[model samples]
Target: MDPFEYLEDLEDDRTKRFIESSNAQVEKRLGQKAKEVFPSLVEKLREERPIQLLVLGNTQAILYYGDETSLEISGRRIKMESRDHVIHSLERVWNSQLVRIGVGIRGSDEGYSLLIDPNGEVVGKIEGLVNQFFYQEGKLCYVKEYRREKSPDGVEPPVERIFCGDEMFPFYPGRGEWLSVTAEEKTTALLKGRGWSEATLYVGEWPELREEDSGKISSVHIVRGRVYYLKGNDVMMDGKRLFSSNHPVEDMKVNEKFVVLNVIKDYRSSLSAFTPSGEPLWEYRGEHVYSFDLMGEDVYALETSFTTSHSLLRIRDGKPYPLRVGRREEMEVKDVYVKGDVLLHGFLLTRGKPKGVIVYGYGGFSVPVLPFSSAIFQELVKRGYSVLVTNLRGGSENGEEWHRQGMLRNKLNVFRDFSTFLSLVKSLGGRTVAMGGSNGGLLVGATMNMYPDLVDCGIIGYPVLDMLKFHKFLAGMYWTFEYGNPEGDDRDFLLSYSPYHNLKEGLPPTFVYTGLNDDRVHPMHALKYTAKSRSLGNDVMLLVNLRSGHNASTPESRAEEMAYVMAFIEECVAHSSSSLHTFTIKK
Candidate 1:
């Protein structure tokens, strides 16, 4: 029933030609501009090496440092290096001298969780999507998904299981529910039910709770064999409430000594330290804390803002002392009211008066919009463009309720949030380009179709455009909880806003790009959408990278691709009718 359905068979001759022709047209049009900007763009991006810091204890820390091209680990007893793979995650196996590193190639779906000893040798390799590991005694226990055979309808569902040492436990994929493991003396597993409000805690082989304990537990941690969790703005340990906050506890990390709570209100996050028994110590109300860990009596945290790209600080007794800080261009926070009671927030980065504004948003999947990225924004700012990052409804900017308000049947709120922000930007009389990737791609794609007048250009990357059949693609079904079921009642709403189906003539100039190696979001979403849009004589450009995937792309490749995008945005803005520079403030 799908007109461009054949494009899903990527190996077909027609699909091959379609990719080739689309890529060729893009190269011919923007290749020179991309080349001219490649050197400076990559250098600007490379200023801050992608690094992940894991505080070991006391003053020691293990830093996993990498770029698009290479990766290296430091502060360990031995050296670890990788040139052909990207580091996805780094976790220390508790009670052992081993560290588990998740690594995979740039474009491939194949990955492994490698348990490395102090000597840097790979002591153990758990394959097949190994993730969410916990260590009990000296054994590593984790959740894994193994690809199973295709059904009669040619759909392959992964067999999920919880592997503990040598034993395996079957995991039921009930409405995409997931399990988490945490251990101190015993390996404890928490099976989160549908809606994530109810959770069953299993300690070793027995249930560790009564009927009343199955309440809205957001996050769980095992400290000294006691469960520390956040429930309804209250920090609870072993069924006893320790501290309650007016604002929601976004996240919490517990250690043997202290528990650090990250609380958010109005899109701003602050960190507070408390004793294991719920007595408050001190609070650090500053820029958003990216990540943090407790060591000894001090809290080590990474904070970032518009002006600060990265700030490593050590806090003791609520007083913070800077360890390292990286500065970036200026950023300002703006609040716009979509409705009388609904006040949306966002971050804007600019230098002087900009001729164009790039409204970038990713308002889904509980992810918050943080103005930490410097490279692309640097290049765009240098080109006289301002960047606006929106913390829309579907994100964790406000809280969990914000996420729930923007997902499932309430998904229209996310689009309305974006459209309202753009309406504000466009009213300022400057060319506005809407950009987002992954779920953000879906955001922009749907918004562009519904409110094309609000956007002068649209950049949708690795998008899910065909909402009706998106569940049929790889990893698409997993998101059914976030984006409602297409075969059910949600289908009517999905079809109403699905970008692939909603594409019409006179759409703003759009740049749709994806990769052949993107096994997560199928490339067909981009190919088919571009094919149909172009067939309708819409100004839609497509670029399918041969060597990249949805993630783990090298710096050089990303810089080159972003250059092409910038070129497209530049061209689109140049041709748009908006002229008045500088955002007009509504006084």
Candidate 2:
């Protein structure tokens, strides 16, 4: 039933020729501009800034001090020499050992975690286990999933098992969907999924399975001899309900005395603290908390806003005291209401009156589009581009209810939300390029198909376009929760808005790119969509980078790819029609 299924064969001669030819055409169009911009972009990317990793003690912690190759612990610096791996996270085990979670630069490469002792010696390296592992006594407890053969119609779930040091399957029996596991000495807290919609909580060395307290669990942690978790909107401790929040709890961190929660509502994130007994401590709102870590009872965080870079802050007495101040750029952001009754929020960032507008959105997976500084966007703004970042539905921007309004059968609400912003930008009279990646790519792809007249061009990167067969690809099965399963009754709904399936001749100029090494969002989505769009006489450019993955590669490769993207944007805006295209505002 899939016409371009051959594109999935990454090693096929025909597939290689197809991608090579498409990439050649794209280079012929925008390669010169990209080449000119590459050097400056690389310089911008390599700019040194103090990146705070984690807080260890009062003054001691792990961080990158204006250097990319080395990490400083307190004052001691250790250089990582692995060309293929980078430190994704750091966890302190016991008092003398640290675990550095290293993820592969390429998406296809399964990375390993390193256990380093006090002498800076490499203690152990465990492959396929990163942050999921926990230190218990002197042993390491972790979970690993063994992927099964893909089904022709349905998505196959991976069989997961728990491994402790050298012992195989010592703790949990049988196979299940293990999401995450945390341990405190002998006690372990495990989260196992019951399909994509719900996850059950299991605690103790030999965790007893309980069906109750199992629905919609976001996170779990075992701290201070108690199992603490966030279920729905309420925080639960040892199966006892703590206080509930008006917004969805995005992330949670715990120490000995208190539990900290990062909650999102109204396009902003707030950090709140509560005691183990469910007593409210303090709440810090306004700025977005990019990340947070606890050292003893002290809370250190990286927080920022739309026009500011991330700043290091220490929270005490319910206040954020800046340890390192962030730099504020010249970019001015205006919060604009896009829908009727001022229901939806979108922020327009511009340095001055712009020549063109870039409308960016990612309205899925309960992920909010918060305000944050980006070097790339800042440069684009300086070049007379107005960027509009929207907090559409299907995200936790408004709350769980807001997310519910844009998922499953309500997925159309996400596209409708995006269309509203595009219409607003188009009404203001300028070229509007819709841009997004991953889930956001799906957003732009679907909206452009439905409302091609509203956008001048689109940039869809590593997208999921083939909704009907998405589950059969790598990691696509996990997204069935947000996007309904296409194999069953959900097929009709998925097919209706599926970007590749809905392609027509009137689409705007589109730039579709994917990493050849990307294991998360399959490259087939981009390739097939580009092939079909070009076949229909639409101007769709395709680029497949072999060295990179779902994430970024080396700064040089990243800058090169970004230069191409910028060139494409410039070209599209230059060719955009000057005629005004307006739509009636529902409000």
Model 1, 109: alpha-carbon shift in Å? Answer: 4.9
lDDT of 2 by residue, 339-386 (tens): 642377787788766778889999887778898866668778878888
lDDT of 1 at 547: 73
Give the alpha-carbon lDDT of every model: 0.73, 0.74
Off by over 4 Å in 1: 48-50, 58-82, 118-121, 135-139, 147-159, 165-167, 193-201, 204-216, 330-341, 584-587
Which one is best on lDDT? 2
**Candidate 1 lDDT tens digits, 1-587:** 77788899989998999899999999999998888888877775555432454554433334433343322334334333544465656666655656677766665465677876655567787876677676654556777654434422333553346666886644444424555655555536364544433455444422242332555576677766677777757888777788887776777888888888988755667888888777888899876776777777878787776666677888888898998876565545444344312777776677767788888898887777754655777778777788887778888766678888888888888999888878877777878899999888899989988998999999999899899988777767667778888999999999998989998999999999998878778999999899899889998999998877876656676777888998898788888655645554432
Clashing pairs in 1: 68-555
